[model samples]
Structure formats: structure tokens, C-alpha cells
Target: MKIGELSRTTGVSIRSLRYYEQQGLITSVRQPNGYREYTLLTIETVETVKLYLNLGLTTEQIASFLTCVLQNKEAFCTEVMPVYRKKLAEIERQIVELNQIKANLIDRIAFLGQQEQGNDE
Candidate 1:
């Protein structure tokens, strides 16, 4: 199939598909007319890429172990553990920071409410 067909089949835009190719996350063959041709198997790879991206994995990170995942050899993709741990740590840190910000905002709002009550007295 051609690039358009792949995009339609995968529900990913042509631009993004090209970007995936450029990132070496996916691949295609150049036809004689300069059009790109893709294999049916590429559909699975694209879906896998989408899954990883939704999990907050970057293309660079996905590339490290995508082949292992596609081949159903995830247990052998040791690189996935470090990346998953790193991403989880980052998310945890952000959650802590956001909690702090939320607490501060709540305190500020209460203080403002107290001042408003005093002014009304």
C-alpha cells in the first residue's frame, strides 16, 4: 500500500507517518515514481508506536525496544524497564509539585476570604 493508505489504515496523519519514518520508528520503501510504499505489517508497528506515545514515551525511547515489542520479546527488552522507571519517577515528581501548588492556592484563597470577612465587619 501507499503512504495515504497506510495513514488511512492506521488513522495517523501522513505528516506524522513521515515524521515516524524520519525518526526511524517506522519505515517505507521508495517507489520508482517517488511515492512511498508500506507493508501491511507496518500497521501493527504504527499502532504500537501510538500506544507507546500515549504512555508518554518519546520516539527515541520507543525506538530502543520497539522491535522487541513487535516481535513479542518484551521480556528481552531490558531497556524498557529503565525508561518506564524514569518516566514514572518524572510523573511522580510532577504530582508532588502540583500538590504543593494546590495546597498553596487553597491557603491563599482562605486567607483572602478571611480578610474579606474582616472588611465586612
Candidate 2:
């Protein structure tokens, strides 16, 4: 398929698909007419790239995993798992920080409520 067809099949914009190619997260072959030709496997590859991006992985990180996968190596166990664990830890820390912020907001709200009640009295 051509680039347009691959974009439609993957539901990713043509610009993003081209960016993915530039980032080495995806690949395409150039036709004699200067058109980009994609294999059927490009659809699945694009989907995987989308998934990795949605999971907060950078293009470089996704590229590493994709390279390993293309080489028939154990991407998950060797390349991807460590990065996944690091991301998970970062998310956990963010959750804790957000919880603390929420607690502070709740306390401030309660104190303001008390002050307003005192003023009313």
C-alpha cells in the first residue's frame, strides 16, 4: 500500500506517519516514481508505535524496541522491560505527588470554609 492507505488503515495522520518514518519508529520503501510504499505489516507496526507513544514512551525508546523486534531479538525482556519499569516508577512518583497536592487543596478548602463561617457568625 501507499503512504495514504497506510495512514488510513492505521488511523494515524499522514504527517505523523511520515514523522514516524523519520524517527526510525517505522519504515517505508520508495517507489521508482518517488512514492512511499508500505508493506501490509506496516499497519501492525504503526499500531504498536501508537501504543508505545500512548504509554509515554519517546520515539527513541520505541525505535529501540522496534529495532530489537525486527532483529528477532527479545525486545520485551532485554530492551523494553527495563524502560517499562522505569516509566512505571516515574508514574508512581507522579501519583504520590498528585495525592499530596490534593490533600493540601482539601485542607485549604476546609480552612477557608471555617473562616467564612466565622465571618458569618
Candidate 3:
């Protein structure tokens, strides 16, 4: 199919599809007329890319294991384990930081509320 059809089918923008091609996350063939051609399998590849992006993995990271995933060998792909672990660790750290910020905000709000009540007296 053409780039447009791929874009519509994947719900991804044409520019993004082009970028994906550039990033080596997907591939296409160039016609003599300069238009790009994509395989039907590119659809599944694009979807996998989207899934990884949604999971907060970079295209570089996904590029490493995408082929393994496409082959249905993700569990056997040891390289993917470290990537998943690293991302999970990062998210856990962010969650801790956010929780601390939430606690501080709650304390500040309570303090300000008390001050307001004192002023109203």
C-alpha cells in the first residue's frame, strides 16, 4: 500500500510514518516516481511501535527488540528484559517523587487554610 493508506490504517500521521522509516522502525520501498511503498506487514510493525511508544520506550530502545517482538520471540529476547526493567525503575522513581510532591502540596494547602481561618477571626 501507499504511505497514505498506511497512515490511515495505522492512525499515524504521514510525517510520523516517514520518521519511523527514517528511524529504521519501519521500512518502505521507493518507486521510480519517488513515492514510497509499504508492505502489509508494515501495519503490524507500526502498531508495535505505537505500543512501545505508549509504554514510554524510545524508538531507539524499541528498534533493538522490535524484530524479536514481530517474530513472537519477545520472551526469548534477553535484550528486551533490561529495557523493560530500566523503564520500570524510572517510572517507580518518578512515582516516589510525585508522591513526595503531593504530600508537600497537601501540607502547604493545610497551612494556608489555617492562616486564612485565623485571619477571618
Candidate 4:
């Protein structure tokens, strides 16, 4: 379909889609009129790119992973495995830090509650 249709369908802006193409994360064909045409598979790839982006993966990492997926198709143990594992570990570490902050907030709230009750008494 056209770029606008793809953008509307994927909820990604045309600028971002073009950026994806420029980043080599997606493939498109140029029509005779200079308009770009996209395939359904491209939409799927864009969704995958969005997922990685949401996880804070860099453009380089996402491009490499997408390339790996495109080349090996059947090879599951390629470079993407190690890359994704490392990313997952980093995410886990961040989650731990976030949880610590949440716990600290809870403790502070309880302490403030106690102080307010004391003041009231």
C-alpha cells in the first residue's frame, strides 16, 4: 500500500517510516511515480522495530537484529540471541532499581502517615 495508508495502519508516522527505511530496518520499493510502496511484511517488521525501540534498543541494535532475522529466517541462534539476552539483563537491572525506588516511596509514605497521626494526637 501507499506510505500514508501504511502509516495510518501501523500508527507510525510517515517520517518515522522513512527513518526506518533510512536506518535499514525496513525495505520498500519505489514506484515509477517516485512514491514508495510497502509490503505487509514491512508492516510486521516495523512493529518489531517499535517493540525494540520501546525496550530502549538503539537504532544500530534494532537494525542488526532485523538484518539477522531477515537473513537467517530459520536460524534462531544467531547474533540476535546474545544481543537480546544482554538487553533483557539490562532491563532486569533497571526493573530492580525501579522496584527499590517504589519501596522507598512506600516507606516514606508510611512514615509521613505516622508523623501526621502523631501531629494530630
List per-prediction Cα lDDT, in the order shown. 0.94, 0.87, 0.95, 0.85
Candidate 1 local Cα displacement, residue 75, angstroms: 2.5
- In angstroms, the error of model 1 at 32 is 1.4
TM-score of 3: 0.95
Better of 1 and 4 by TM-score: 1
How many clashing residue pairs, candidate 2?
Answer: 0
Model 1, 1-121: lDDT tens digits are: 9999999999999999999999998889899999999998899999999999999999999998998888877777888899999999999999999999999999999999999999999
Over 1-121, each residue of candidate 3 has an lDDT whose tens digit, in order, gives 9999999999999999999999999989999999999999999999989999999999999999998889976788888999999999999999999999999999999999999999999
The alpha-carbon RMSD values of the candidates against the true structure, listed in the order shown, are 1.4, 2.1, 1.0, 2.6
Over 1-121, each residue of candidate 2 has an lDDT whose tens digit, in order, gives 9998998898999999999999987778899999999998888789888888999988888887786765574544488888899899999999999999999999999999999999998
Query: Looking at candidate 2, what is the lDDT of residue 71?
Result: 57
A best-first ranking of the candidates according to their TM-score comes to 3, 1, 2, 4
Error of 4 at 9 (Å): 3.7
Residue 2, model 3: Cα distance from true site in angstroms: 1.1
lDDT for model 4, please.
0.85
Clashes of 4: 0
Highest lDDT: give the candidate number: 3
Best-to-worst lDDT order: 3, 1, 2, 4
Clashing pairs in 1: none
The candidate 1 region of ten consecutive residues with least summed lDDT is: 70-79
